[model samples]
Target: MTWGVVAIAGVLGLATPLLVRPLLRRYGVADDPNERSSHRERTLRGGGVAPLLAIGVGYLLVLALGNTAAVGTVLLLAGAAVAAGLLGLAEDVRGLPVMVRASLQLVIGIGAAAGLCIAFGQQWWAAALGALLIAAYINIANFMDGLNGISGLHGLLSGMVYGALGAFSGSAWLTATGIVVAVAFASFLPWNLTRPGLFLGDVGSYVLGASLASLAVASAMSGISLVTALAPLAIYLADTLVTLARRAARGEPVLRPHRTHAYQRLTDTGLSHVQASLTVSVFSLGAAIVGVLIPLAGLNQWAGAAVIVAIAVVYLLLPRLRGSRLPRKPQTALVDIDRPAAIAPRVDFYPKRWIVLGASGFVGSAVADHLVAAGHDVVRLTAPRLALMPETAANPISVERALNSDDFDALVRAFEGSDVVINAAGRATPDSPADADLYGANALLPAFVARAASSAGVARAIHLSSAAVQGRRSTLDESLDTSPFSPYSHSKALGERLFLSFGSPDGETDHVVIRATSVQGPGRATTESFRHIARSFVASVAAPGNQPTVVSSIDGLVDFVTRVGGSSGPLGPIMLQPWEGHSAYDVLSAAGGSPRILPRWICTMVLVVVRGLGRVIPEVAGAGRRLELMWLGQDQRSEYTLEFPAMPNHVLVGILSNREDAS
Candidate 1:
C-alpha cells in the first residue's frame, strides 16, 4: 500500500511541472529582474508545485500505512507545503508587498515550527526560534536560487538524506515519504534542464525550507544526530542569516529585491545560471555525504556540523570576492586602480573581449597598456577611429554620425565575444569646443559603449569618469556624494546615468562608474604619463650620485601625443599640470618624509642646472650628479650678519664641487 501510494504521488508530483512547463515558458513567469535579481533572463518558473504534489501523494501513502509517528508528521508537512506554496505562488504572480507576503510566511512558518516542536517535545521557544530558522532557511533557498537546477538539486540531495536516515533509525514511513519526494524531484529533472522549464516558485522554496527544518528536528528526535542532519544545510543558512543582519543594520528593506546574495554575484560574472547552480549543488551533496557518514567515520554529530559551518563562514564574502575590486577614488588617480570591494573573474585563457572608449588618448592609452599587460585583448573605440585618422581627439569629435556608420558596426562586432568593457575614454572638451566633440564624445560615447558592451556578451561594464565630476577639488574620496557643475562634468555624470539606464540589452552588465582624479603613471602613454615624468625626480633623488642618466627616471617612460593630451577636449580627467621641473611638492615627496631643513637654494639651483641641460639632451635631465649636488649642501647664507649662517653642508658641498675630494 505504501509503495502504491508513493508511486502515485511521485508520478503526480513530477508530472505537474511537465504539464505546466510550456505555459510557464510561454507566459514568461520568471523571477523579476532589478538591481537585486540574480538572473538576467526571465526563465520559466513556478515548478515548486510539483514537490507539493509529491508530498501530498506521500502523505496519502503514509495515511494508508496506518497512523504512525511518521504519518502525523508527514500530514503536517503536507499542510505546510500547501500553505507555503500557495503563498509563494501569489507572490510570484501578483508580486505581493513584502510585509503582506512575509506576514503570511511568518504565520505558516510559525505553525510549521510549533507543530514540529509538539511532535519532538521541544519547548515553544524552540518553535519560536524555529519559525525564524525556517524563515531564514527558506530565504536562503530563495536567495540561493539564482542559477538553474540548484534548488531542485539540493532539495533532492537533502530529501535523500532524510529518507536514508529515517529508515536506519526506524522511521520507515518518514523514510518512505522522503524517498518518494526525492524521486519526484528526480523525475522532473529533464523538463527543468537548460533555462529551467519551471521555477520552484516561492511555494517550492518555502516547502523545501520548512521540510528541511522539520527534518532536522525529527532527525535529532530519532537519534540520527543533530549535527549530521544540519551540516549539509549550513552554507545556505550562514549566507541568509548574515545577509539578514547586514541588511537590517543598513536599514535596507530586508525582503527587498537586491543582488546582494553570494550566488547572485557568481551569476553576475558571465557564469551561466546552470554552472553556478551546479557548483553549490555539488557542495550540498558532498556535505550530505559527509554528514551521513559522520557516525560511520567516528566523528561526533556536532563535528559534522562544524565542517559545514566552516565552509559557510568562509563564503560570507563570496559575492564581494566574485567581482574585481574598483578604485576608491577613481577620479584622482590615473591608471587602472583596483578597489578592494570589487572582484574580477580570473578565467584561464579568459577571453580578452573588453572595450576601451578613448583607446587613442592618454587615459585610454594607460588603461590599455595595463590591460594588455594583464592579458586582455583590446578593441580601441573612438570617434575618428572610423575615419582612419592618425588618432582620436583628446576631446569628443563630430563622432556624431559615427554611431550610424559601418565603423560602429565593426566596434559592435568586436565586443560580441568580450567579457568586460572598460569605458576609459570620455568627452573632456567644454561645450563650446569647435570639434563638436563635447556633446558627441561625452554624451553619446557612453551610449555607444553601452550598446557595444551589451551586444557583445559583456558582463562587466566599467565607466571611467573624472574626479572633476566631484566639483572643483584638489582631492576627493569615494564617500563624498557631491554633484557636477561643468558641461564636461555634467556630461560624465549623464554618461554614467545613461549606461546604468539603457546599458544592457539583457541587463547583465553590473554597471560600474569610476570617476578618476589626476591620472598619471607609466601605464598611460601621453603627456599625462609625464606627470610621473616628475617621478623621475624621486628616482633621481633616491639614486646614488654619478649614476647613468639613461637609468634615470626618464628611462622607458610612458608616451603620448602632447597636442591631444594638452587639449581640454572631451576626455574628462585632465592630465594635470605636466611635470614642469620638480616643485617643492616633488622634492618632499621624493624625500619620503616630512621635509627637514634641506637647502632649497641648492636643490632649486641644481634643478635649474639639470633642466637647462635636459632641454639640450634628454639624457642629462636630473642625472645623479645634479641630484647629489642638491642634496649635499644648499643652505641659506647670511654672511653680513654677525652670526655665521650655514652656507651649505661642507662635507656634502665638497663632494659636489670636487668629485675626487668627495671620493
Candidate 2:
C-alpha cells in the first residue's frame, strides 16, 4: 500500500490536539498534575478524539474509492474502541471511580468483540482470547499514556507491524485497517509532541490497544501461542503484570491509578518523555519482529515456545544479571565419621572498603561478598533494618531510616572513608501518589550521596541501575538514549546524574554508573524480575507447550558486575540487553529445563543475524528484528548456526531433556 495512509493519518493525528485543546478549556476537560496525575500543566484530556475523527475522515475518503466493506469493519471496531475509551474520557473530564470505569470496559470489550473481524470468520478460541486481550490491551494502552507520545508511538509502531505483516491481497481488510490506524497515529503524534492539542484520550488508546490485541489473537489462531504473538508487547506486558501483581498483593487498586509500570519507572528515571517512549518503542518493535519469525523458521511449536520461554526468562533476569544467584543450600553438615579431622579454612577474603546500598537484598549480598573477598573492608547499607539479618554480619551495617531526608545524615555518616560505592537500592511505588521518601532514597538519594561525594572529592562510584531505565519491552543497547519510563527509572537517572555530576570537576566528583541487564544469582534476589523468571521457568517446564506470561532467550546478552578500587575491567564498552534482550530460560538452563518460549532453531537464526549484522551494517542490533516487524505474510528462516558463544549444544540438550521430564 502507498505510504499515503500513514502519512496522511500522521498529519491528522496532530489535528486532534489542536482541535481538542480549545474544547478542553471550553469543556474543562483537562488533567492537573498533582498527587494522582503526571502532567504539570492543565492540558487537554480527550485528545484521543482526534484519531476517532481521523478514522471517520478515512472512511469518507475511502468509501468513494469503493472500499465501503473495509471501512465498515474499520469503523465498527474503531467505534467499539471509542465506546470503551469513553471510560477514560469520563475519568479524564471528571475523575470517575475505578469500579465504574472497569465495568464499562468489560462491556465495551464484549461489544467490540462481537463487532470485530470474527464476523468474517475466526477461530472460536481466537475470538474469546482476542476479546480479552483486546480489552486488556485497551487499558494497557491507556495506562501507557502516562508519558507524552508513549501510547501514540505504540499505535504508530503497531500500525507499522500490521503494514509489515498483513498481505495486501490475502489480508486486504487488515491491510486497510493498518492504513487507517497508520493515518490516525501519524495525525495523532504531532499533537502529542511539540505542543499538546489532543491526547489519545482513553478512547484513542483503547482503540489502538484493543485493535492491536485483536491482531495478536488472530496471529495466535494461526497456531502461534499468545507467548509468541505478543512478544513485541512483552515489555509492557511484563511491567504491567509485575506492577499489577505487586499492587494487588498489597490490596492496592492495580487498575485504578498508579504510575508504577516499568515504562513509568523509566520516565521517572530521568529520561525525557520522548526518550522513554522511543526506548520502549525500540524494544517492542524489535521484539515484535523477533516474535513473528520464531514460528515461521521451521521450528516446531515446541521449539518456538522454548525460544519465547527463554525470552520471558531474560525479561526477569536482566535486571539481576550482574551478580550471580549464589543461593547455596544451607551448608548441610556431614556426619563426623566421614570427617575425623576437618581443617579450618584460611582467611581468604577480606571485607573491602566497599559500600553497598540495599545490602539486605539477594544480589546486593552477593555483590558485597564479591568486594569483601577482594580483601578490602566493606560496609553494607540497607534501608533501615525492618528485618534484621539472621546470620551475623561479616562486615554488614544496617542503616535504618526513610530513604528520603530522614536518613541522609546517617547515610552520610556511613559513607565516610569508603572507597568504592555500589548503589543497588530500588523500590516499588506508583508515580502518582509517590513514595517520595523511597524515591529519594533509591533514586534521588543517590544524587544526594553523589553531591556529598562531590563535596568530599570522593573518586569511584558504580551505580547499579536496571535495564528498565531503557524503557519498552524489547532488546536495546547503549546507543539508545536513556528512556526512564516510570518513577523508579526517572529517579535512577537523577541518582546517576548525582554521581556523574558529583565526579565532574565542576561538581567535584566522578563515578561510573553500570546499567546492569539484571542481577541474578542466589536466594533473596534484589529484583522481582529475576524471581518472576525463576517462578515462571519452573511453572512452564512443569507444563510444557503452555505459554508463560513472559519470554526472552539463552543467547540473550547479560552483564556481570566485577570491579576494583580505582579501576575495573571491561570498562571500555560492551552491549547490555534491555529487559527484552536478556533471556531468562538461558539462565534457567544454567540450572536445568528446556525453554518453552523460544525454539532453539529460531534462536539460532537470530544469533546468525546478530553476528552478520556487525559485519554488514556495523549496527550491532535490530536489523534482524526490524525485518520481523514487517508483514508476516512471507515466512522464511535465516541460515542456522552450528555454534554460538556461550550457548553450547550440551546445555541445549540438557534443557530439552529436563523440559520433557518436567512436563
Candidate 3:
C-alpha cells in the first residue's frame, strides 16, 4: 500500500512539470546565461516544483489512506520539505537577499529538526545539530546545482539508498518518505536531461537538500547509523567544503561566482556536462552502496566510513588526474560540444558527412581526427605521395585518398555527397624560397576547392586562413582589412578573398573563412619551436607581460570548425579565431618556462634597433614580424558573439604534456 502511494507520487512528479512549465514560461521565470552559469540559453527554471508537489501529494495520500503508522514523522518531514520549496520559490520569483534567505532557511531547519526530535523523543542538542545539518545541505545542494541532471540524480540515487536502508531497519515512515523522495526526483530527470531543458533553480535545489537532509536526520535519529545516512551526499559535501576551504585559504571571497568546483573543473578538462554529472553520480552511488552495506551486512561502520572517504578523495582528485592522463583518442562522430549546459532550442548544424582537404598536415589531421572521433562521416583527401595517418584511422567511417591539388574535376567529384568541406590545405612556411609552391597551395587551392564544393552541391566550405594576413596589427579581428607584410601573408590573403568570392552559382554552398591566430598543439613544428624559445636562457618578456596575444589550440580550432561548418543559418563570410585568454607570457609559462621580466621601454628600444637592422639585412627583415609579435603583442577581441567553446587551461596543459610525452 505504501509502494502504491510512491507509484502515484512518481506519476505526479512526471506530470507536474508539464503543467507547471507553461506557467513558469508565462511568468518569465527563466535562468539567463551568465559568466558563472553552466548553461547558455535562457531556460525555464524552478522545475523543482514537480518533485515538491509529488512529495506533498504522496504525504496527503498517506493521510487519506489512514496509514497512521509513523504518520506524525512523515507529516513533519513533508511540511519541512514543502516549506523549503516555498522559500526557494520566492527566491525564484523575486530574488532574496542572501541574509534574508539564510535566516529563513535557518528558521525552517530549526522547526523541522525540533519537531522531528520531539517525535523521536531525542534531546534538544540533537535537534540543534540536525538543524545545522539541514541548513548546510540546503546550501550545498544549491551550490552543486550548476550543472544539469546533477541535483536531480543526486536526489534520486540518495533517496533510493535511504529507502533501502529504511526497509532493512523496519521504519515504515522512512521507507515511504525515502521512496517518495526517490521517485519525486527521478521524475524531474527527464525534464532536465532532455531537449529544451529546465533548471532546478533555487526552489528545486532547496527542496532536494531539505528532503534529503530531513530523511538522513530522521533515519539517524531512528537508530540508522550516521555514516550510512551521509554516504549518498559525501561527494557533494566534500566538493563544497574543500572548494570553500581552498578559496578561503587564498583569501578570495567565498561567495564569489566562479567555476572552480571539482565537477566544473572536470568539464573544463573536456568532460561534457552529462559525463561530469554522471561521474559525480557514480561516485555518490558507490559511497551510498558502501553506506547501505555497513548496516545491512553487519559490516563495521568505520570500514564504511573509510570506503566513503576513499571515494570522496578520488572524486576530488579526478580533474587533476584527468589532466595528466593521455589525451583521448578521437571518437567516431562529432558529439556535442563540451559546453557545461543543457541543449538549447536552436537549429542543429552537425554535418552528416565531411571532406577534409590536406588531411596529412598538422591542423588538417587534427580537424579530421576530431571529426572522425565525433562519429561524422569523414573523407580525407591528401596530396599525392603524402600518406594520411589520422588519429582516428581505426574508425571505419573515415575514408582516405590521395588527390592532386590542381585537378578541379577530381576535387568536385571528391566533394560529392558531403555536407561540409574543410579546406586545411595551405603552405605556411615563411622561409620557403619556392614562392610558386606557396602560391599554388595557399592561393590557388582555395579557389579551386570553393568552386568544386559549389559545383558538387556541398552545403558549406570552411577555409583556414592565417591571422598573418592582417600583419602585426595592435588590434586584430575579422573586420580588419588584410595588410600582408610578406609573400606568404599575401598568398594567404589572396586565398581567403578568392574562397569567399566563389559561392555556388545556385547559392547551395556557403563559404566561411576562419582567420586562425597563433595555433599551437602537440606534434606541430610551431609548438616545438615556441617551447624551445620559452625554455631558452634568453627567454624574456616585457614587464608585466599582460598583453593579450592571439593563440588558439588545435583542439579549440577543430571545435570551432565543426560548429561553424554545421550551422545551417547564414554566417558572416569571415570569422576570427575562437580566442582562449592566453598572453605571450602565459603561453611561455605554460610551456614550463620562467621567462625573465624586462622593462617595457628596454624591450621597445631593442625592437626599434631590430627594425632598423631589418631594412639593411634580408635575413633580419623577417625578424621584424617576430619582433612586433614579441614587444607590442597582437591583441584580438577575445570574446565572440557566436557561442564557440574556448580551450580551458587544463586542456592546454594536457596538450603541452602530450607534446612532452611524445618528445
| Candidate that would win on TM-score | 3
Can you give the TM-score per candidate against the true fold? Answer: 0.48, 0.46, 0.49
**lDDT of model 1 at position 563:** 18
The CA lDDT at 420 in model 3 is: 90
Misplaced by over 4 Å in model 1 are 1-6, 22-28, 31-40, 221-224, 243-255, 268-271, 294-297, 313-663
Worst 10 residues of 3 by lDDT: 334-343
Query: Cα lDDT for residue 405, model 2?
Result: 49
Where in model 2 is the C-alpha error above 4 Å? 1-8, 35-38, 59-64, 67-75, 95-97, 115-125, 196-198, 218-229, 250-253, 294-302, 305-663
Clashes found in each candidate (C-alpha, N, C closer than 3 A):
45, 105, 10
- Candidate 1 versus the native: TM-score? 0.48
Q: What does the lDDT read for residue 427 in candidate 3?
A: 78
lDDT of 2 by residue, 1-663 (tens): 345555555566665566567777798776667755657676766777778667655545545555565655555556564566556667767777666776777676666555553555655655566667777877777777787878777777776666455552255556656567666876667777866444566667766776677656544543444555677566677667766666644433344575656566555556777887887787667666666565445445555556655655464444334332321211111111111121122233222467777776655666667666666577788744221111111111211132244455566677777655666666533232123454445445555465545544454556665454554334344422455533445445444444443343552233545555433322323323333544454322222222211222222211134432244222322223223222333444444434454453565476567645433322232233222211011111111111112223343233323343221
By TM-score, the better pick of 1 and 3 is 3
Q: What does candidate 1's lDDT look like per residue over 231-318, in tens digits? A: 6686677666676566544433344455656666666666776777776766666677778777656777677777776666556555
Candidate 3 per-residue lDDT over residues 541-577, each given as its tens digit: 7878888766558877877877878765546677787
**How close to the true structure is residue 254 of candidate 2, measured as C-alpha lDDT?**
47
Give the Cα error of residue 133 in candidate 2, in Å. 1.6
The CA-based lDDT of model 3 is what?
Answer: 0.78
